[model samples]
Target: MEIDYASHFSALAHPQRLSVLRMLLRRYPDAVPAGEVAQALNVKSNTLSAYLAALRAAGFVTQERDGTSLRYAASPAGLSALFDGFLRECCQGRPDLCRGIGGDLQTKKGTDMPFRVLFLCTGNSARSIFAECLLRAIGGDRFEVHSAGTRPASQLNPLAVRMLAEKGHETDGLRAKHMSEYQNDAKAGFDFVFTVCDRAANEECPAWPGQPISGHWSTPDPVAVHGTEAERMLAFQTAYGMLQNRISAFVSLPLETLDNLALQHAVDDIARKD
Candidate 1:
């Protein structure tokens, strides 16, 4: 269904509406009840009801009567329109520019030439590990991704391993690796080196042979939390959720248009969640 773009955006302009949309995005294809969404976000039922009504009227959500209540789910066409609009506007009218940054959302077959990416952090534990597993799972066959730490850890953080498993990704072969493992190694230099730690981002990095484009994510260390096991796990989940969100945006980038600096700037803008 064709939707009024203005109405759709207007409905999303409010903070609550956007938050609700994000909550739905996190549960795509799963129709969540109005009460459940309200409770999860701590919004008053009536206030959230109004937001949902606006969203439904704007075609951002679809509502179905499920027994005693209604369930709201994402309208893919609506979301595509919204994000596609974003891609066009922010990318300066060039959708292909997304490929230059690292997007491999769903690479075409026979076009699986692997791009090299290195995920870095201070301890090679949580954030970097999440990036590696996430990229491998979602980056199509277009990437050969590795995660390493500026200061290597003797073992992988167990929480990171557990979280990855919970996310339906295999953690069998994952281990904490040293940044030195690939730095200056003729065979494995990266095409993109993303530092997930403040320390790693500021520190002098090993000279990448290809002079990989670099960026900093600066995620807080989840393993450093002094808390009960449940609290620490919650912290890890929070970090994982944040990383997952950023990675989804990063993977939407167009890596093929870097030769055009104008397009590169636009891609960069979209890649940074800040």
Candidate 2:
């Protein structure tokens, strides 16, 4: 099929249209309801519909009837064709520009551009916060990690902050934040997003940009354990240990070699560790 390169570019030219594409890519294989998409981007229903229509007309998006509402997803074939065509035309005479296009794009960019990761939970007071700090320490400059809650606590859990500090991780900059801060902003693209609590894992999430690989690591909420100070601290310690092990495993993965599906499976497998 002859790809309409100009139409695809034009469709992607608008900021809102590009935001729609990014959201669609984040939910790539899964079709998201139009209403959900609109809510995530904070775009008005009428405006969102117009943007989606343009994407659909450009062959960049595909829609399927899901009961009464339509669900939309990025067209992988169309996107692949569009990008390949763009690169080919741009590099037609510049062989040097095409030399390092294959393999993992992450590695190709090297560690100068850190991989962005976000951890999510219901409260943002414990598990998610711990994972964020742990991964940041382990991955260092290789990762830019952040954590948030669906319904965030007013502040970081005292136990969590102390536990991380005792272990020599910086807790100064860590604070509980709402997940909504990351949503609706197209520029806040994440490379990977993990939900550390069961509740947040099950809840509907905003569409993230960059098609971030996502997984659930169900760690027990330490705050729920009400006991003596020592016992409560032990619970926090246990949660910390679990996250440390998982983050260790995560950092050791050959991310530069694995494809997206393989990388996703690797991430899911980490959750199975005790």
Candidate 3:
């Protein structure tokens, strides 16, 4: 059945539903519990129930049962569909008028721009930074890499820096960056955007531009460890190790030639690596 875009849009027509989608995006690649969503929005459970139902119905969000509770994750396909459907109908033949908007959502495929990849997480401090440094060292000139946080820390995590330096990766110029910095960088949209959030963080992940191939590479939050100095260093080391493994596997793929669906599968497989 053809979706009634005009009517379905009513799902997000309200401010609360839109905010709910934005909140889920922060934890993209991970699901947020319904209760937590309510807490975060400061809405009563009953009210949030209506908001979530509307989003799910409109395809902005999806929910799954975990035990007896419900967890929600933002649906990328829904947003992509909304954009594509709207443009197809709205811009019909006048591609010139919507050219920039359409182009903004495209990957740098069939171009010599190298693979523009972004690593996202709650904080650009640890797992993401580790991935950035590893890819820079491993992928060489075949990839252009950057990392940013949904809620960036004021500075890069000291433990992360120390661990990277000890591993012989360049830690200079490494700092936490907000995802917003990339908004104005239109011409440099990413081909791949990975979320490295742990399972527990109630994070707000980035709304990646250009429909980049995305997957979740969940790593433990080393920054959350509060223990003896030795134990804390161990946490950073563990997180770094997982990202190193994942990025190393990622750099091995023949990414440039893979079709869109293949690229998506490749990244999803990389996320499952040890």
TM-scores for candidates 1 onward, in order: 0.57, 0.61, 0.73
The sequence of per-residue lDDT tens digits that candidate 3 reaches over residues 6-121 is 86788878998888887686566567789888887788999999998888888889999999999999887888787677777777836764453322225445666678888888
Residue-level lDDT of model 2, residues 223-266, one tens digit each, is 99998999999999999899999999999997766777678768
Q: What is the C-alpha lDDT of each candidate?
A: 0.73, 0.80, 0.78
Which of candidates 2 and 3 reaches a greater TM-score?
Answer: 3
Candidate 3 local distance difference test against the native: 0.78
Candidate 1 structure quality by residue, lDDT tens digits, 1-274: 3445667789889998978876664344457788888877789999999999998887789999999999997675676677666666666767465443343222322465677888999889889999898888888677899999988889988878987898899888888888878876776356677777555654545467764655556567898887899999988988887777777777776665443343334434443553
- Pick the TM-score winner: 3
Q: How do these models rank on TM-score, best leading?
A: 3, 2, 1
Candidate 3 clashing pairs, residues 3+ apart or interchain: 25-205, 26-203, 26-204, 26-205
Off by over 4 Å in 3: 2-6, 76-112, 149-154, 177-189, 198-216, 260-262, 268-274
The model with the greater lDDT, 2 or 3, is: 2
Per-residue error for 5 in candidate 3, Å, reads 4.3
